[model samples]
Target: MSTVQDYASRLSDPGSRKMGTFSYLPPMSPQQIRKQIDWIVQNGWNPAIEHVEPQHAMHSYWYMWKLPMFGETDIDLVLAELEACHRANPGNHVRLIGYDNFSQSQGANMVIYRGRAV
Candidate 1:
């Protein structure tokens, strides 16, 4: 039988990576950012960039209202579209906003923006 340590090791092995996205609702505070980071770590999703490192490749912030109000249905597709949009735009970092999943869908469903922070 496998020991608890074995399972724990598997979960913590950064090599076991999962891709997920984040988008922030407007009016969010620093505390909210901490909460979000905690959620990500707890979920075992490893970000491509370190949270504290300057010039991280995939750091972002998203405003809720900027998201598309309707038309598109699938969250994944929306995320892909938003990512593509960001790729087209010039920027150092991108934050997905309004990428929400309402129906208990798993994984990332955030709408984000990509640009250099001022």
Candidate 2:
């Protein structure tokens, strides 16, 4: 059996991790995320926001901020909601998720927006 120290030695350093669309890259700025959201909206995908504790990096689930924004195209509203979620869950890892079923058939796209540690 692997000891806690053994696991700790095998684990990579704690830091922001990449997921979906822009994996293997640095975290995107708010403006960059806004552009991606806009593009997804233009492509007819619904947007949703979710977050997770940084320490729970390997966990498969995240807490949803609000229901998916179906048919909503205004970027400001999304940005506002994202900001609110960040404020409410400071030090957590927030994400913007998009879903499209008709055009691309892909159900999800995700991007991380790391929150400042309080």
Candidate 3:
């Protein structure tokens, strides 16, 4: 059977716009973050950190922090990098990127911190 359907546009959320999977959820605990980072490492994905001003976060490519931790297996080191990014850019949105080498593409990306004060 073939069917034609018409769709209507709906109003956007009144809540402030958000980006990334974790951004829409409650702030992730350190344990949760550790678990996610662990998965990134276990999957051999290169971890990278990025940040951008909240105003630009919705429409801009986040600025990379230093460089991607290529060939890094230590989860603690990744966490440390994230912490440093936060310390240095406390007023910007921070995210974690897991890049897959074999696929030569991003395997995972998540918002680790939303720096805008609520």
Please list the C-alpha lDDT of all candidates, in the order they appear: 0.36, 0.72, 0.83
**Range of the 10 consecutive residues with the lowest summed lDDT in candidate 2:** 5-14
Tens digits of per-residue lDDT, candidate 2, 1-118, equal 8754222221244353445547555567777887887897887888888898766645788888989887889999988988888899888878777777576444655645664432
Q: What is the lDDT of residue 86 in candidate 3?
A: 92
Clash number for candidate 3: 0
Across residues 1-118, which tens digit of lDDT does each residue of candidate 1 receive? 8754322212333322122423222434545544553454445442221111113333343222234423343444534544555565545333432222444332433223334533
Top-down TM-score ranking: 3, 2, 1
lDDT at residue 65 of model 3 (Cα atoms): 99
Error of 1 at 96 (Å): 7.8
Alpha-carbon TM-score of each model against the true structure: 0.28, 0.74, 0.82
Candidate with more favorable, higher lDDT: 2 or 3? 3
Cα error, candidate 2, residue 111 (Å): 3.4
Q: Which lDDT value does model 2 have at 107?
A: 62
The segments of candidate 1 whose C-alpha lies over 4 angstroms from its true place after superposition are 1-24, 50-91, 96-106, 109-118
Best model number under TM-score? 3
